[model samples]
Target: MKVLFCGDIVGRSGRESVTRNIPRLRQELGLDFVVVNGENAAAGFGITAKICAELHGAGVDCITTGNHVWDQRDIIPYIAQDKRLLRPINFPPGTPGWGASQYETARGQKVVVVNVMCRLFMDPLDDPFRTVDAEIAKYTLGRSAHFILIDVHGEATSEKQSMGHHLDGRVSAVLGTHSHIPTADSWVLPGGTAYQTDVGMCGDYDSVIGMKKEGAVLRFIKKVPGDRLAPAEGEGTMCAALVETDDKSGLAKAVRPIRIGGRLPPAG
Candidate 1:
């Protein structure tokens, strides 16, 4: 199975980029499923129902969120009914929306998408290591699911990398998000699972992690409140990962980071 996992989509620039490039990228890569982190798809905050639907209409099969999942209060109720939108699995039981969902491609193949958030440097939550184990156990090898993709949303790259290794043999792909900067270590693990420290944000690269440059500088330099940070405006880049996983074993066979448009250098 071929799957593409896109990093956080910042705001207008990020959304526009996805709208412009995702259809073509999906076709060019022969993607069977696509998952995008929508935590920052709003104006550098939480996602809204309208934006979630826009992502769905743009070929993204599932949308994942992190700590910012609740930034938009209006989308709370919609999350309960929208199976395509997922919050962190480690969230308490009463949290709105699900943490994992299954989708069938037009070809009739089943794909399982799971979202989990790490505790280190993030909101305290249920143990991710234990939580994922239980979720993976729900599907047996070679039965209900042929593909399983996991989105580990966290701030610590080390924790994310650790998760990639922890789920090496059990899941198809383990990709990281939350940090807007894309990492270069996209590779298939020894156990055949595709892994990357981070897939990066799909927004304007001209600013600080997709936020407006001057404001980010002010917030950091002055250590005080300034104008609200806005998503960088201008042409944006589409940052994501292209992964291929084995059907029978549900492990990644290959992985690569994809970055197109905007100002950042290509992944080498």
Candidate 2:
């Protein structure tokens, strides 16, 4: 199975970059399934039903979100109707949307996508480790599911990497998001699971992590809550991770980082 996991989409630039490149990417990479982190898709805050429709129309199979998933109040009611849109699995029991969902490819192969957020320097939600362990137990690799992808949205690299290693041989891939800066550590783990500390954001890199440079800098320097930060209005680079898994074992056969346009150097 060939799968692609796109990092967070910040704003218009990120959205355009993703919607514009997805069709071509699907053809170029021979992707069977695509998952995108859309937490910051709406003007750098939260996602909405309209944005969800656009991403889905552009070829995204599932959309994952983080802490900002609820920044847009309108999403509260919409989330219940969209099973493809996921909040963190570790969210409290009554969270609106699902944390994990099962999808099928054109070939009728099953793919399980799980979204979980870390607690370190983040919201004090349920235990991600235990929560994900229980989720994984629901489906067996290679038999019940052809591919299992986990999106570990977190602020700490150590926490994300720990999740990757903990589920090394069990899951097909464990990719990180929310950092908005691509890391160079893209590789298959010893147990055949694809891993990366972060896949980066699909937004302008010229600014501060996809935000306007001025306001973000002012807040830090002045030690005051300056103007609200906004997404950088420059060209965006679509950042993602491509993983190809073995058909029989459902383990990663190859892992590669993908960066297109904007400031980051091209890679696949």
Best by lDDT: 2
What is the lDDT for 104 in model 1?
91
Query: Any runs in candidate 1 off by more than 4 Å, and if so which?
Result: none
lDDT scores in order? 0.88, 0.95
Q: Per-residue lDDT tens digits of candidate 2, residues 89-145?
A: 999998787999898999999999999999999989999999999999999999999
Q: What global local distance difference test value does model 2 have?
A: 0.95
TM values, all candidates: 0.97, 0.99
**Residue runs of model 2 more than 4 Å from their true location after superposition:** none
